[model samples]
Target chain A: MKWTKRQRQPKLKEHIKEDPFVTDEALAALFEVSVQTIRLDRLEMNIPEVRERIKDVAQKQYDPVKALPEEEIIGEIVDLELDKYAISIMDIKKEHVFSRNSIARGHHIFAQANSLAVAVINDQLALTAHADISFKRQVSEGERVIAKAKVLEIGTLRTKVKIESFVEQSLVFEGMFSMFREEKKIKEE
Target chain B: MKWTKRQRQPKLKEHIKEDPFVTDEALAALFEVSVQTIRLDRLEMNIPEVRERIKDVAQKQYDPVKALPEEEIIGEIVDLELDKYAISIMDIKKEHVFSRNSIARGHHIFAQANSLAVAVINDQLALTAHADISFKRQVSEGERVIAKAKVLEIGTLRTKVKIESFVEQSLVFEGMFSMFREEKKIKEE
Candidate 1:
């Protein structure tokens, strides 16, 4: 619905707060306003552009988490449920492997899997006690590795986590991880 | 030996080329000149600051080796020899690990190893066929991981590489990588 500028300005601020990465162009279409109007509204609200907003969030929100710091997770956590399941995505880059092979080095795949595994643990301190891991297939450079980690068992001092990393539908790596949870508090989500 | 203004200018240029990360203070100390003079010399030579030089080099030298670009390698390549050995150093930061644990994400440590492994391969097409890997200890954030990769065996189509990652001489992770050399060229070293 086409809303008045007075009404649209307030809505714009709220939308940006909800998703900082929301584009001005998209907001223009959503609010039925010109791009200039949206930019003006953002300037009036003292809100930076989408790129700056992301950088601001990265700097501010990359704080300590329940299990670890936000930034140290191999890939950004797109979804999470503590002690249950978690997912992360990493864009394989040229730096991730040998220039000759163009395939992602094994550990890059492992990093994505391992971090997602640790993040799913509900604790302040989660350390890898042991892991039975293997590379199932070769992952090429530039392929995105989507790692999904599931909690298999939650014991007194240890948790069994299973991680399977894939490029699209193809599985690249899998691991059965034993995580040691130190100082576990009885918290439920 | 201390060099004068006339002699120092050329040497300063050479030093920056050798190590773009060289500090202005270090250059000043080496040439027995003020920091301002170093800046002036840099300005006169049309060279940017250390940070800018690094960015420039990253942009230029990070060529697509095979699958990934050179710049994406986790740490600076302090030393390298194709199909032989490679050494890299990574400074752990809050950005690289879980905040609460302060331990680096496994992949980061793995990245240091994997990148070094790829780097040590002589072929222009080096791919990790398989890796038997293990983590020996937890590496906390703010520690440096020195990854050293050595070629265990070089075959006609594959090279067996061994990567050991350490923090202050204490082993953290070890892996035996079987890298596939898809196309081997008889290039002189």
Candidate 2:
């Protein structure tokens, strides 16, 4: 089936969304277009390269801010749904390690989890009231940590969030955060 | 009161203990010795210089390890009394800051507090079960953070610890940790 440029672009976005890890070559074959055409469409559509696509998919998935400003979040939140779930990714670099050893510091790991816990709450203001956490293993420099925060329970004044961080498939850190949130106000008619 | 060299050395140690921040010149004046003699006495006693003395005072205040190995603590613990209180110090260097901005990352601060919280537990095995923490201010490169942990309550299987971090006199971070600890065992007669 021959497809015009206008028709293919929207489909390309949808195709990539369904599988963010899909390679450009595979996308070109599926779209029945030249590789160059696929590349141009992606560029015009402002889609990032495939590697970044894995981490960037969350950018468009949901509204990022409710409890705190986006800039205040420790990691780039790749996916979010307030008072439900959220995901963020952080790259460990030279600056995040101890000079004597290249292992990423533990607090860096905690900050990512703690911030994600705060970000997933559905209130205008959320403060962490308590947390229980463990370091499962050490993460080294050059590793990327993906932290997922899931809301366990919600109440008028508090929410419980469970956060687990992984380097690839390995669990590097885990925590449970009890967050204090301002009560949701009733809207005027 | 003419004190012999042997008598004066013990007194010097006592004086320094009373005030770890005492100047070498003050020690000389108090001990009725020349400044060079005071320096020699301090060196012979293996005392660190005054600048380091303030941060190092905790080294002699308590037994350092109960829950975890001393080396595993994120900051250099200078004071500790397991299940009671502890203090640690960390110097923020280039390696601990963001490359783009010199502000120390939030996790570094959290790690210091978390580790201190764990260190203060009076058990052979202690794990952080939960924490509620907040970063009060941004810490910059070259700043030194002092973290103090105090035990709030003790339970047969769980303990609560409160931790606070300061850069000099300014509060930088604070946290409350609920820790899980192995229960004490009774010795067989």
Candidate 3:
């Protein structure tokens, strides 16, 4: 029995399982094939596309509980959906405080909040489309940081969420994010 | 004259010239010294601290440019100012565009936009405090990206900037960044 490239493709899935975030180019290089060929293999293997993979990895890595290692919570989610939106509040850590220096790295905090916002959405998959953020105060590394998010609007194709991250009752970061929810289709009889 | 360990220390300016973006850990490892020792050297050299260094490097590396080879742009800006910022549209040939999987990696666009937003600020140094970004459309590998930025608000110690990145006329990404601009003080007579 002769094995064709198609017959050998399932093995790629195993490699992907080992590193789901690996790129098609890497796979192509490894298999001595073109990137388009590797992509075809990936599509056949039911692997999510690169964009999907990124959101998935970000969702896992930026899990609020994991991202905020030294912080404690103060508020609970009043509302959330499975479509990749969530909201929560926690005390800021002294070590997490912001100086001119720390604020410069503010994306960490925004990423965390945005990740949680996406996590609570009702869809099985969601990705950020856009965001507007306003920072009101400097937060200390160890100060208590309060976070809150709400679905401002949900459309048939898109969803908009608002998130607020605060420290010591002062608003440190306020954000509005537009998210794209991958809707599941129903087969019509 | 014999060179002692103290004399062997790279001149701060020369070290920065070698690679302004070199991490303290990398510098330490290269110089056969501890991270703390490298930091002290940086301090004595009037270089910003580690976090500051990261912010500076990240900002300068992320800015937008009118036109130039991506590599040349990246190379020209090396170590210009510890806190210098600039932005250039990411072309297809640049390494980070692919290495970071930006075309497929959803957040790389945001990362690049965020980095450029921080980089274009005028403070002798600035860092991203927080940013909210929206990805309007998926940018492809060969697309021409435009990163536009302007100061939204400038506080006594902190400044906010709004950055909108577009691919042609389409708004591909938009972000609002809060940065801590180091204010140089003028001594009173």
Docking class of 2: incorrect
lDDT order of candidates, top first: 2, 1, 3
For residue A21, what is the lDDT in candidate 2? 56
Consecutive 10-residue window with the lowest summed lDDT within model 1 chain A? A57-66
Which of 1 and 2 is ahead in lDDT? 2
Candidate 2 Cα outliers beyond 4 Å, as residue runs: A1-51, A184-189, B1-85, B89-109, B115-146, B149-189
Q: Write the per-residue lDDT of candidate 1 for residues B58-150, one digit (tens) a residue.
A: 565433334245676778766666666776778788877755556676777777777777777655556566666777898887676778888
The TM-scores of chain A alone, one per candidate, are 0.63, 0.71, 0.48
Off by over 4 Å in 3: A1-85, A88-104, A184-189, B1-85, B88-108, B124-132, B139-171, B176-189
lDDT of 3 by residue, A1-189 (tens): 433677658778777777554567667767777889777777777788644664565455443432112121223332344434454544344333333344323544665566656555665455677677666665555444546677778776567888887653457778787776666222111
Give one digit per residue, the lDDT tens place, for model 3 in B121-158. Answer: 55445555566566777776756565656666666655
| TM-score versus the correct structure, for each prediction | 0.55, 0.51, 0.43
lDDT of 3 at B59: 68
Residue B62 miss distance in model 1 (angstroms): 18
Clashes of each: 20, 11, 55
Best by the lDDT measure = 2
How does model 2 fare in lDDT? Answer: 0.78
Better of 1 and 3 by DockQ: 1
